[model samples]
Target: MKAITIKQPWATLIALGEKQFETRSWQTKHRGPIAIHAGKSTDKDACNDSWIKSTLAEHGIKSYKELPTGVVLATAELVDCYKVETTVGHVSVLSNVKVVEGLEVAFGDYTEGRYAWELTNVQVLAKPLEAKGQLSLWEWNGDSK
Candidate 1:
């Protein structure tokens, strides 16, 4: 399967279905099954936000260190890629959807020119599969890198 590496706790958010659209600097043409890999790098600053910290805590992740890394957390379909048309304060205008407010706003970079990769049908792995992650989309051959 194909996969993309994302920094925690974004990866964890996606895996847990707390966030639906993965924002990117560019658009993609590929649309199919994609694995969600939690990269080894954690955004400690993002994790420190009160709301983010609380959300993670609700999921039983009390510390940023407890978030899984270097592993495939879930498999999801790359359903659609939308260009972020504009934003006013908190709402991000995508091709056919709008991210209104709250965590959807807080969890992503809603800059006007970014692409939002819509993920659906998330299937979290029973246990995380240990694997090294690569930049952009990559092949997951069921082994550690």
Candidate 2:
């Protein structure tokens, strides 16, 4: 399986299905089931953001300690990747289609030139597998069965 390492609260958000898009500076052609890994490093500032905290609270995540790190937390299909385009007044949309404002706010930068990697069918791992993280999409040779 292919895996992508994501920083803290964002990784938890993805695993919990609250975040549907993973923003990246680059786009990928690989589209299939991929493991979502929470890197050892956390985005401490994001964890303290009002929007992030409120969003996590809405998902029943009260503390950053509840989020797993340095492990493969879940799996989801990378269905699409599109550039985010934003206009005046915080209106943002993908280059190919319209995206919900909440999703854009929760999962993306909502700025031009960034790619939105759409994820679906998220399945959290019952037992998170410990693994070292890599920068981009990487192959995970471990048994997923």
Candidate 3:
């Protein structure tokens, strides 16, 4: 499947459902199964931040110990994509994704970055694997890149 690499902490946030908006500088016209590849990089300070710690605690994230300096934690599929309604304008959300492989994820978003991935399947490639958090169309047939 095609993938888009993401930085650390942010990647973990997606896998854990902490920060929902997968902020991208551009918007995608392609819609289909996209892979959530956690990049092999980590922000130590982010891992220890009070907000993240508290959020993980609430979510019962037990793998924090394994989040090393650089590693891909998990992988997921964006099964569905949509434009969410809001006060400002519609934003994207990948809805109803299955955490097929990695840790259990459950978070929400209300920003323009990104809300959810319509996850159809997931593969926990590694708790701290050497990969990148990337998202991209699995066999993009669309004209937009």
Best by TM-score: 1
Which is the better candidate, 1 or 3, if ranked by lDDT? 1
lDDT of 3 by residue, 3-59 (tens): 556665566676665553454434565454444555566566666766666666776
Full candidate order by TM-score, most accurate first? 1, 2, 3
How many clashes does the backbone of model 1 have?
A: 0
For candidate 1, give the lDDT of residue 136.
82
Candidate 1 lDDT, tens digit per residue, 1-145? 8899999999999988888889999888999999999999999999999878988888889999899999999999999998888877768888887554667777888788899899999999998999988888889976555
Model 3: how far is 120 from its true place, Å?
7.0
Off by over 4 Å in 1: 97-100, 143-145
Candidate 1's error at 60, in angstroms? Answer: 1.4
Q: What is the C-alpha RMSD of each candidate to the true structure, in Å?
A: 1.5, 2.2, 8.4
Each model's lDDT: 0.88, 0.83, 0.47
Model 1: clashing residue pairs? none
Lowest summed lDDT across 10 adjacent residues in model 3 is found at: 97-106
Q: After superposition, which runs of candidate 3 have C-alpha atoms over 4 Å from their true positions?
A: 59-65, 68-129, 132-145
Best by lDDT: 1
